[model samples]
Target chain A: MAKRLQRASETVFAPEDPEFQIAPMVDVLLVILLFFVSITSAETIKARPQSLRVLELPVAKDSKKKETSAGEVVINAGWEDGSGMLEVAEVSTSKFADPDRMRQFLRDAVKADPSLRALIRADRKVEYGFINQIMLVCTQEGISNITFAVVDKERQG
Target chain B: MAGGGGGGGEEGDYGFQIAPMVDIMFVLILFFMTAAMMKVSENELGIKAAGTPTASQEAQPAEIQLRIDADGTVSFNDRVIGSPIDDSLAALRSRLKEAIDLFGEKQPVVIIPQSTVKHERVIEVLNACAAANVKNLTFGGGS
Candidate 1:
């Protein structure tokens, strides 16, 4: 038995064959490549709730682009003493008081245009609770594109 | 069989070994397990999208946009609530309940946030909405 095992070991070298692993390596490489591709593809499509506010960047008006996009809802927010107030403004009119009313206004605005994005221009001192309400309203309206008007960090700094 | 020393072996004898594949699978399992452990520390809410994509045209009912600024003042839609964030929160609950009743339970409710708002204020709104039984929730960046 010892002599037979020694002879077998001499003849049967595990790494001797060049094509021994070609098929398996190719299969594994393909699988790994597929895994990475799927992971990155899914990431780009994944959406998340936004917390950062965007300030409008000035641009030259393009008539063709204006017709396709809806109008914007701008809120100029401020704080009084410890209380908070936001003035809802548009090209035509401005209304103040009652957060719920503003929520309704947002709903109406969204209904009218369906594609309009809400732009909140809030004072630095405004409280966090009011911000939450704005977010809640946006979620309710299904308005996904929300931008915050901010001073450029680089420019401001 | 080819004209080689082992060509005399049976044609049906060739088979691939699974031991290396098993090792690779074990490595993958370990990688995922370690990665999953890292995820447990993060807030799950922070990961969820508040609404549809920017171009989505889905119809939505009247929603309350609650803004909580850096100072903790609360607003619904764009209107600022009375002082003491709690009052605004209570008012928000009542209004939300009324809207839910009028628009039906499935209507979406969104929270638009500013950059400097306190994290605690956001949680307070979430708690208030949950308490009021408003299930449809979303968040977006706001001024």
Candidate 2:
């Protein structure tokens, strides 16, 4: 048994004919693929609520581009399909018709982080009056940092 | 994982299967390609919202008043700057650009749009302002 093992080691020189490691290579590819699949699923889940609103934002050719921040407060303004009423949302998927509720949410958000930015994602079809009300809430809350999300005309369809 | 690579190899016989590897690679490539197209980048235009009434008021400065009519007509300081529905607000952009070029970027602009006007119209006006480089912009015609 000892002589047989020594002869096997001598014949199986690692550098001479290294195995192509097909299994581990496949394992690495699978890991990468799984990572990407997870990322895509999470993104889809996160975007579902926002995409349900069907906001066709106006294309702005010269709107200053700013990156979305984690610390900022987002206010989505859109029209409800069934009732044609104004809908507002904070971070949750739930949409509400009450501006007062949005006001309260903004107030608390401001209280939590005074420097938090309020990003408005209003549908282009919605009347300016509704958006004005949101601006008023921001003003009342003393949270002056505001941003409007628009589709960039430079990258338009 | 083992089933995908599960075919046990015989003694000294490699069990590498190009078929499954090729299948997963194709699926991953297709998913990635589609994912790349799924993202829509949103650009932001920033402005300072009105301060709380209790906050100290800014000192009175020269303010330019802009009004958007229900018909999408925009007037700058009561002067007709052409309707966006007709001219893409080209005239407005030029006038604002000329003013910014002359006075400075600090020139404040306040837009007062009719309550019934579509927000698209307002954004069009805002887009023109951005093109013309209006630095200080306020909505609702307030100080």
Candidate 3:
């Protein structure tokens, strides 16, 4: 009886048990989690909010063009489909509207950050007058660094 | 005897659980996949502000004037180039290059686009100027 009982206890608590080991699996999951976390954070700089519709940017043949740096103020210029009006950063303005207010806004922004640059994301179908007006505002506000956002022609393929 | 054996089998069945852990990992993977799909790449073309003095008049050998009508017609130095499209852009580029050779590379090319012209057409003109190695560009006919 004593020998039989000893064999039964050893079988129940054996050294090589079939129990699941979590350490190795946990380590792998942690590595994958870190990789995804890094990717998501790195992408936030270029991602705009979903509420803003993307403009069909003009294509530039220069594939090696530089991208706008972070922290620069980006102003979106697109035609509002509903109202059929030109919208600059969500403000509806006429083709011949006064640019004083826009200039003042840029002036204040530049004053707060001297190294600030202005990036205009205008739609391809937009008229030149709208873009010129925004450029004029940027100049009058004393903001010299200005760039137009464009899509890479070669990369579209 | 059968009851005692059944009790012993039940005790041995308790081990580490892995189903919950795998569920959590799958959830995390789904979240990241969605986030990565939302990101978009952006590119930019640098243009000098109008009011800034990009080049001195003495350094500029000559000036080339470019005009774009409301109908996407492109003209250089008052002479209209070919139709304002990809095929005709080559002609515009050559004309711009000729001006660059006569006026020196530092010549400023001023672009005057009518308010009704499409912005894409203006960009095409700008691209042509860039291809001709013209560095100094200015926008005229104020908004």
Predictions in order: chain A TM-score: 0.47, 0.59, 0.54
Candidate 1 residue A28 Cα shift, in angstroms, is 66
Model 1, range B1-143, lDDT digits (tens) per residue? 11223222376675554555555665764565454433211111211236465455677776677776656677777787624446337777777778777877566777765656644455556556654666667676667
lDDT of 3 by residue, A106-146 (tens): 77777888777887777777788777877777877777777
Candidate 3 clash figure, as a count: 0
lDDT of 2 by residue, A1-157 (tens): 9999988998886457565676676677777777667656653121323434667777787887565566676677776652223344453456766566767777788788888887777777778777777777778876777788787653334
The TM-score leader among the candidates is: 2
Q: DockQ numbers for every candidate?
A: 0.08, 0.37, 0.32
Specify the highest-DockQ model's number. Answer: 2
Per-residue alpha-carbon lDDT of candidate 2 for residues B1-143, written as tens digits (9 for 90 to 100)? 32355466677576767757657675885687576456555677877665424244656447788898888888889887876565368888888888788778767788888876777888888888889988778786421
Name the regions of candidate 1 deviating beyond 4 angstroms: A1-70, A90-95, A153-157, B1-49, B53-143
lDDT of each: 0.54, 0.71, 0.68
- As for TM-score, the candidate ahead, 1 or 3, is 3
Which scores better on DockQ, 1 or 3? 3
Question: Of the candidates numbered 1 and 2, which has the greater TM-score value?
Answer: 2
**Top-scoring candidate (lDDT):** 2
Show where candidate 2 strays beyond 4 Å.
Answer: A1-52, A81-93, A154-157, B1-39, B51-61, B141-143
